[model samples]
Target: MDQSYKKIEKLKGEKLIEKLFSEGKSVVAYPLRLVYLKTNFDAPVKIKAGVSVSKRNFKKAVDRNRIKRLMREAYRLNKSNYFNNIPDQYAFMILYIGKTKTDFETVTKKMNTLMDAFLKQQSLPKP
Candidate 1:
């Protein structure tokens, strides 16, 4: 099966985005915060994900776009490290929370940190 991620797989819509932010629990790992919800879809891969950067932190559209681009790139390259860390079928959102624009190298490092945190979260004993 082709595993290339297409944009359509991304979680969108006002209501869904709201759920990820409010209803879903969050875990912070420096540049990114993982907001996740277990999904009804049968696939083992993440059904959808959204990446966001705060405009309040980055006043310029170019800087915001640049950071968003780097976040997406990091997700694209390192997504495999996290897909199995989550539940078999789930949708996730990783929000950028840093106050400054960052280079791709920094974004990628943050992605790795987030994924490591995810693994730690995954291994915790359930109540």
Candidate 2:
């Protein structure tokens, strides 16, 4: 409950990462796409997150790293918006899809919208 992004909050391990992409449900808000799966893993926290930027869009490693850092910061700040509402544990991967670099303000707004959308989605009964 520190509200900080600690090592435990970061998603890792090749198998776990692969499972998240293969089985997770996704939500998108412009520059950001979130893929998440509910799990029963025995972890200390309720959520784990990973951020990524496609090399196809930003060829430079520095650009990709910058975008990912921005994304992680946004998520870390707004995560509790949806995190507090969910009872189950989850793993998430956030992907950057914009063709060009976006400002922090834009990414922050979109990240809030994305988490809000996720909260709304969870309230609906699955078909």
**For each candidate, what is the lDDT?**
0.73, 0.84
For model 2, residues 28-93, the per-residue Cα lDDT tens digits are: 998889898888666778889999999988999999999998998888887755576467888889
The regions of model 2 sitting more than 4 angstroms off are 124-127
- Cα shift from native, residue 63, model 1 (Å): 0.5
Candidate 1, 1-127: lDDT as tens digits: 1345686667777877776677776678887888877656433445577788888898899988888888878887777655643445556788889886678998898888876776677673222
Summing lDDT over every window of 10 consecutive residues in candidate 2, give the lowest-scoring window. 118-127
Model 2, residue 122: C-alpha shift (Å): 1.4
Clashes of each: 0, 0
Local distance difference test, candidate 2: 0.84
